[model samples]
Every structure is written in structure tokens, then in C-alpha cells.
Target: MYWSVDEVDATPYFSKTMSRNRFQIIWKFLHYNDNANLDVNDKMYKVRPVLDYIVEKFKQMYQPDKNICIDEGMMLWRGRLSFRVYNPQKPVKYGIKSYILCDSATGYCFNMRPYFGEGSSLPDTMFSLLDRLSGHGYTLYMDNFYNSVALCERLLEAQTNVCGTLRKNRGEPQVIRDLVKTDLGIGDKVVRHNDKVMVVAWQDKRLVKMVTTCHQDGMQKVDVWQKGHKDKVAQFKPECVVAYKSHMNGVDKLDQNISYYPFIRRSLNWSKKFVAYLFQMCMFNAYILYRARNPGGCNTLLKFICSVVKSWTLKVHERKGSELGEQVEEEEGAGVEDGDLEDVKHTLRAPYNTDPESRLDGDLGRHKLCYLKPTSKKLRPTKRCRVCIRRGTRRETKMMCKVCCVPLHAGQCYIDYHTTVRYSVSVQG
Candidate 1:
């Protein structure tokens, strides 16, 4: 159960020549056999079957005491070399989009899919995760991107429950009448829904009527009035007539250590793509497996792994005076020795040994995180390779999330209050 890329890279078995900095390199070799001629897409296709293998392995490895909360997320991808896609509405760089299904309770990744270009069937972004789980009756949560009358109907057919943000301008129209005195509008038999909400204004005051499939949730019998909030007048606040189950997006789960291999990734043909995907899935699954071993801790499994890597990297320094070491020192000044370097290392360790405040507190999760912790340590050791330290600090170097490159622990990534409460319901394209 390794946590960081450094750990994965440090494994004695990997070829010495392999570049640990770019994880995609390792993935490329494992998936494509270090063959430059083979196509990347072809590798991805071959990797699909590995998913089935992972599913079997997952079932055998962990037997949950109870049904776990499963949530799905997707990443949009284009060709490897490019970052943008050709969407007239919003074009993005050519890259890969990944879809993931995570066990909310454990914050472990259960399944993942790497998408290339847009194609038919496209796994129905609305129901992609459901398709992967191969079961029903589960409560699925998503943003407005997955909202649709047809998809809702499908969920009903499967006996699965779903609660998501409603798409704007996609609701049934209501007829309301403005009566003599009150600005309130009366609708036809509106049922009582929410226990409390502010009424901003009335449309017609009288003859208020609304059509909605959600009427059964006990909202059909109350007065359906269009209320405006102080935030925005154009957008009306939703006033549910009945008490419906309020579904929220589960807390942010662990983040996967991912890398973008823009150049080589795009050149792959179908055959190579399949094979590469197989390797990608295997490695990602390995990442999830690693996280499962550690329940709660600072830094994610990915961060842990990277820490191990940094520690192991010290071993490279251990090989001082060796042929490779000499060349490294000559070619890269980072390997050069300095008298004060050791003193700096010792000073940093003193607090961990003598002072409690300097020690890691286990209460980071409770601090109400302001933003994902910075990837780079504000202060760095002067003796260590600045390049290596830079990798740890740079958003791109950490093969995890842009917000925080550290490896994932057992639970999902931390999210802010606004994102959890509001944006959780709305879907993204």
C-alpha cells in the first residue's frame, strides 16, 4: 500500500532508466512495452478487460460490513498533445477525461474510465457510474449535467433513487393569478413541500398552477408562487410544496494520482490505446488498493507515496561518489554538497523531537480547510535538490490534483462549504 509516486518509482524492480518524474512514462512502458511505434489508443482498448479483472479483485479483497456509498465523477479528455477540444460553446485543450466511481464511505476508487474523443453511446454521462456498478436501487448523486426527464425515468425503471440539481428552464410551466390584495399568487392544489422558505413575490397572485413530475413528492397542493431572492432577480428561488428527500453530494473523496501525457498519448492508434489503457487502469487500481490500507491520515495515499519517494530519493544521495552520482553532481548542481546542508536537516528535525507544536496534528480534517493545502512547502531545505523540491511544489509535478498534488488518503479530497452545499447539485459538461 504505497502512497506517493516516489514510492511507486522507488520499487527496486522498475528499470533504472525509467523517469519517475513523469508517471506517464512508467504507464507508457507498462502499457506499451517501451515500444515507440505502437499507438496509444490501441493500448487503451486492450486495458478495458483489466477493469473486469479489477472488479473481481475488488470483490475478493474487501467485504464491506454494509453497503457502501458509491459516487461517480468524470474527466473530459482530448488527444494527448492537445489540451483543448472543439466545442463551439467551450473548447478545451486536447487531453484525457477520466470517469471515476468511488466508495463514499471508504473514499476508495471502485472503478475508472479514461475517455478519448467523443463517440457514440459515450457511456451516457448521466448513467455512466450506474452502468459500471452493474446493480440498482442505489441512491445516486450528480450535478445538473445528469438531469433529464428521460434519465430520471430510467432511474425509476431500475428502481434506483436519484436526487440532483434541476436544470434551469427545464421545469414544467405553472399558471398563477395575482389577486386583489396580497402579492402572493395562488396555484392549483399545491401540496406542502418544504417546511420553510422565504416567499419573495408573486407572479399572478391567483390562478397559480405548476406542472412537474415531482408533484408526487407532496408539492402539488400549495400555492406555487415565483419568488425572487436578493442574490439575483432573474433566477427565482425554488419553493418546494412538499417535503422531498434533500439529497446532497457526498463529501469530496480521495483524489487519484493522475498525469497528462499529451504528446505520446495523442499519437497512439487504436491498438496501442487499448494496451495503454490497460496499464493505466492497473496502476490506478493499485493506487486505490494502497489507499484502502490507510483509513485516516494527513496527506492522501498519493502524498504518502510521494513522501516515501522523497525519502527514497535521499538514497540516491546515499550513492555519493559512485559513477552515476559523480555525473549527476557534475550535470546537475542539485547533487552538489554543501557544509550547512546537514545542519538545516538537523534543525528541522529538532522540533519534531523536542516540541509538540511542530509535530503533525491529526485534526487537519476538522480545521474547515480554506483551500486544498499548498503543494509546495513554504520553506525548503537548502541542501536538497531545488529541482526535486520544485517538483513537489509545482502544480504540474504532483501527479494528483491541481489544487493539491499530495497523494490521497482513504477519504476523498476536502471540499469547501459552498461547493458541498450549492454546486453539488449542478452538473458539469
Candidate 2:
């Protein structure tokens, strides 16, 4: 979802045609139903209203502030169909993408851009977002991906201060103090990794450079005498000539946060897929809230309650049947016959009932096909099955599936199902 300052003020009421709450409910539904997708006509009225409300509320919360942080994440979709406007990435092969601008100072979200593929196009995408900001004097803290001379110059031109990681071999480092060439040790040295700052100079312009002015935030230079003439602590404090490296060295951690989710469903022009994303987000939000509220409480209990309530609320009515009953005519307009009547009775299968003649008989040379089982089965059962024995009644005993923990019969318990459910319970229960 996206919101602008002007849109926040206008506060448009979501039309009644949108059935589900646009902000919370639709996404919540999409979130929990792993197999479900969102369509374009999916009820978005409910979510739109809530989103409208949230924007209004946030505006009130930050009435005088307009500072925002800009970033983008791609939501991948892997399906047979896709939108002409939003094409999938060649390598990624599927999924939509979205860029979000959040308020860094106050954790409030402000803008979103749903697209097909931009996750891999970081530099260009960041430039586009900066253009949107349009000369706003905002302090944009970014990672190494946005750490380039060209990007920094563009941001500086736009009056935006980009404080991000420095490329390893691209620019000069910021020097706080100087070191004697002879005193410098070869290779690397052992030092305690703690919250301590070191004064080092940019050795190679090709190795370390910044687009910022060299003008002083503040600069101090201390005279250095022979090493034995000075205090040993001073050597470490004023001139700890450590190797200069980028601040954001943990690329793996950052990469993990830049993956796909449901928000990009609309990029594919599929409302069902998008709704599924929103639903998942809401569920994730709910789970986090519940965990925060009740540290040791049963997540299964909470989830079960939600499922029951959702099932009860969503009506699944069966249509009444009135077309031809068991009566059968011998031929077109001819009188009905006993044989034809029996055949008609056989054809009229009732709901929740199976045809009795479809069953196989062993006397007809048919038996359950028995194939040799593999020496090992990969799936395991879940711990919720154990609850069956403890509860003694099936009423409150819905076991988590061993594979997906999406609730399954306990009789077909496998090792794979067991481990999968146990892990899910531990991480998400």
C-alpha cells in the first residue's frame, strides 16, 4: 500500500464495492492461506478504509514532519500468467517487486511503488527514488549497493546527504591521525572487535573515495614523538592505524532482508495474489504481537481460534438441486421404464455421498496396488499429534501436518512431517 501527504489530507473513503478491509483484512486472508491468490476485483474496500485511517492517524502523529526514508524490495511471483506492464525478471523467472519509502526517524511508512523487477537494479532504482524526493534535504542512510561516486554526486546535487557504506577499492578513507611508515606492521593485526573508533587516512583514492566535501566536520592533528617517549595508551587512542573498510560488511544479512513477499502481487495485476500477500503480512503482524504479548503462551491456541472464527464467518453455501430427480423416460417423450428409472437413480449422486458401484472387488482381480516402500521416508510427524492422546477428545485436537503444519490427519504421521511441524511450532507456534 502507498500513501502521499496530499492523499493523507484528502482522506478518501473507500467505496462500498471493496468488501474486505484494504489495509488489514484482505492481506490477512492472503497471508494465512498459503495456496490462495488475490484477484483484481478482490474486496479492497475494507483495507482501503483502514489504510486511509492509518495514514490520517500517522499524519496526526507526525503533523509537522515530512522526512522519509526511501528503499525498494521486490515481491516475486512464480505463476504461468503475468501482466504485460509488469514483466518478471529473466533470472528470477517470477514475481513482482515493490519499493517503499518509510520515515526513518519515526518507523512510519509513507510511500510504495509496485513493479515487476527492480531488486537487481539498485543503483538506477535508488536514483529514481531520489528524483522523486526532488532536492529534499534528507539524510539518506543506505548500504554499499548505493555507495558509488556517481550516485553520491547525484544525491549531493539534490541536497540529500547519503551516509552509506564506502566501496573497498573506490575512494580515499577519512584520516583522523597519521602513522609512521616504519612503525606500520605488515599484513593484519589482532584487535578486539568492540565499539571503538580508529583514526585512519584514505590511502588510495582508487581504493576509497567519497563524493562529500573534505571541509571539516572537525579536524585535529596531534604531534607524534618517538614511540618510547609517549604513553602506550596514546599510541592506540590517537593513531590506531587500522585498515579502512566499508561499514556495512555483512552483505549476507542485508541480502536476506531483500527477498520476495506478497505486496508485489499487484505488479502481476492479480488481486488474489496481492491479497494473499496482505493476508500473510497481517498474520505475521498478529503472530509477532501475540508473541510479544504472551511470551510463553500457546501459538497453536491463538491460530486455532483465528481459523475457527474465520471459517465460521466465511459462508460456504451449497446450491439447492431442482433439476430432474430419479424419474427417467424410456425414449425422449416415451413413458418411463423400470430399467431407465434405475439408471436415472444411479446417475443422481447426492452431495457428500459416493457411488457405491465405484468400489473395487477383490474377486474381480482387483486389489490395493502394493509397491515396495523406500528404505527411508523423508517426512516426519508433528508434536500436535501428541495432543490427541493428551486431550483424549477430538474436539480441540487439530494436529499440525508433519510437512507444512497446515493441519492434517495424524494417522499418516511420517518423520518428515514430525520434524517440519516441530520446527514450525518452535519458530511460529
Candidate 3:
């Protein structure tokens, strides 16, 4: 059905007419899962083709700005999947986790990797992400999970600067952690570093720790609305902490943009769920590009989404074929008396009103011949066979006419039954 957003929203027709079937009966993926173990990640599954295609398009569609961010995001999935990750901090606590590399300023996602049970090589991912922006002097901001001394070093080697909160276990100097416990006043921060990178032990409310390959001992003053003072007092903070706070939400901001008008649907298949998320991401990235080029263009993303949906729903050619106003008025009420009514009646099909026996089995319908397997061997219905009815025998059979929804004897009986109505060939042969 051609679906306009207005029509879909105006009336809840799908639930009423189509029984709200979420999937087609014959739907099959081009790729199949070749996994020997159902417990591990199935990367070669059918959705892999579509997933690769979508991710490639997402990366090629946009060039991220100088300030990029590395972050992990969760696309919600409650299905019974082995690789589902639970991060308590995210807006969605339970989901499939993915690493996202995004533009800090514009929230344009350039690349992503799905987490598949393994604690994936974050440092390797960081270097690979900046490889796309090599020689561009981009700065990447991240949270503690993806941030490490090795990651920062690798990013620096790739000519991309890094800044983010770091865990104490990432092999930073012991003194750095000790400095935070010292009697440092509010807004006072200490830094220890060699020639390449700096680790800052900063104290504001409690102790805040950050590691960076991009900054010196420089400090910037900013107002903390809730954390610092009730009046939003300005306090000195290290430049690394300042930049990390400013740019850490690049992926999250993109999430916010797409999430406000999400297209996620409950699906049993993992690939289908991922594809829905990818579609949402693509539409949102397009919106971001649209606004950047046309600043004076539109209002909210919801309005834009509705317009796109409605546009796709419209058939331009069909509308253009419509007659002119003068022609329409001249032809109106000029048809034969019962012609339109007869045509409408002919077009509509009601189960009882329409002749069931005269109806063709359809061009695509299948009919086959097989031994009427015993009830103990097969799942087909066992009934007093229709084929034996004419022969005056009440022998039961396990075969059934699928289309006509009736049980019949197998073999020539099945062939004769379908050939009597309409079927292109004997499928069982």
C-alpha cells in the first residue's frame, strides 16, 4: 500500500485491515547464518550484506570536521541474542553496543563497529578511525571506556589529537591519581607529562581525571551551572577537561537528533533491527547535511521527517495524469446510469458474494501429488478424503489443498482436483 504519513496517522487502519503482520511470510535474507555455535556472534549472517552496505554509505556520505569524537552507543534490543550488551549509564541500558566515530561539531557519524562479545581493540579502532582523517589534524574526544594511554599514543602517531577521561588502570603514572587526593583547592588542577602527552588530575566537586595528547598546562575559565555554584560561577579548568566536555557528545547529539523521531520497530531478527537503526541514521545524517547547506530551511526534524515520508507516498505520475478542471467538470455525472456502480461491484470481492468454485487457483498457486502420509508420520490434516468421496470409500488421507483450505487424498486425486480448477503445472512431479 502507498503510505502517506497523514493517512497512517489519521486512522489506525493496519491493525484493523491487515492484522498487524510485522513480517511477510516469504521474506528471506540473501545471506544465511553459517554459524556452528549459536552462542557466539554471527557476523556472516544474512544481514551482514545490508549492514555492510549501509555502514559504507554512512561513511562515504559525510566528511567529519576537525573535532571528532569516539563513543559507544546502544541501539535497544530486548531479543534473546548472545551478544547483547548492558551499559547502565546509557539512555538505553540493555542493547547491542556499537562504537561510533563522529564529527564533534556537526554530529555527522563517519564510521561504526558493532560490539560482538569481545572487548574489541579500542586502540586499533582509534587509529583506524583517524586513518580516514589522516594529515587533517583532527582531535578526538572520548569517555573512559574507549580512552587509554595506548589509544592516545596511537591517535597521536596518526596525527589526530585525543582528549577524554581515563580509567586509573590504563597505566598512567601512580602520582597522577595521588595528586587528586591531595588538598587541592576547587578549580586548582595539576598536570604531569613528558614531551608527547599530559595527564591532568583536576578537582572540582570530587576528583576529576583526564588524559590528553593535545594540551599543555593551560587553563580556561567556564561557568558550571549545577556542579560549581548555584549562581553558575566561573572557575578555572584545564584545557583538556574543557575540550573533552565540549566535544564528547558528538555521537550522542546525533543519537538525540535521530531518536526524537525514531523509526525503530520490534523485530525478531537481529539484522532487521540493525537495518531499521541504519535507516534512521541515514535519514538523520541527510537532515544534518540538509540543514548545514540550507540554514534558513526548516523547523524541527519531525516536520522534515513527515515531509519526506509524505513525498515518497505521493505518485507524481499518477497525479499528473489526472484530467484538467474543465475536462473533469464536463465529464462529471455523464457516465452510464449503472456503469460506475456495476464496475465498483465487479472490482470488490467478498468471500460469500464471489463464486468460490469459479475462482481460479491463481497463476502462482502450487498443486502437487504425494502419498497420503500417515498421521503418525506427517503434520498434514487427516480427514475422510474428498477424493474417495466420489468412489464411495471413506478412506482418510493426510493431504490437503493449501489454497482451498480443504483436505484431499494425495497422488492422482490431488492432481485431478487442481487440474479441475486451475494450476499451471503438477508441482509434485
Across 338-378, the per-residue lDDT of candidate 2 in tens digits comes to 44435434444333222233222213222111111122231
Task: Report the candidate with higher lDDT, 1 versus 2.
Answer: 1
User: In candidate 2, residue 138 scores what lDDT?
Assistant: 63
* Decreasing TM-score order of the candidates: 3, 1, 2
| Strongest candidate by TM-score | 3
User: Candidate 3 has what TM-score?
Assistant: 0.67
lDDT of each: 0.37, 0.36, 0.67
Each prediction's TM-score against the native? 0.38, 0.31, 0.67
Query: What are the per-model numbers of colliding residue pairs?
Result: 91, 45, 1
Which candidate ranks first by lDDT, i.e. highest?
A: 3
Residue-wise lDDT of candidate 1 within 1-429, one digit each (tens)? Answer: 875444345565243423466666645555523354545654344444555576556555543322223333323344343322333322233334455555545544454555445463522643554454434455454444444445545655665544444443433222222222243444323222222211111233333322222323332334333456444333222333232223222213333333332112533444354444444444444555656666564245446544555566566545632543332222222321354334324333332213223113334432221112221342221122212232343212211111111222222222221123231232321
> What C-alpha lDDT does candidate 3 achieve relative to the native structure?
0.67
Off by over 4 Å in 1: 1-43, 46-94, 105-107, 117-128, 131-136, 168-303, 306-429
RMSD of each: 22.7, 22.3, 12.8
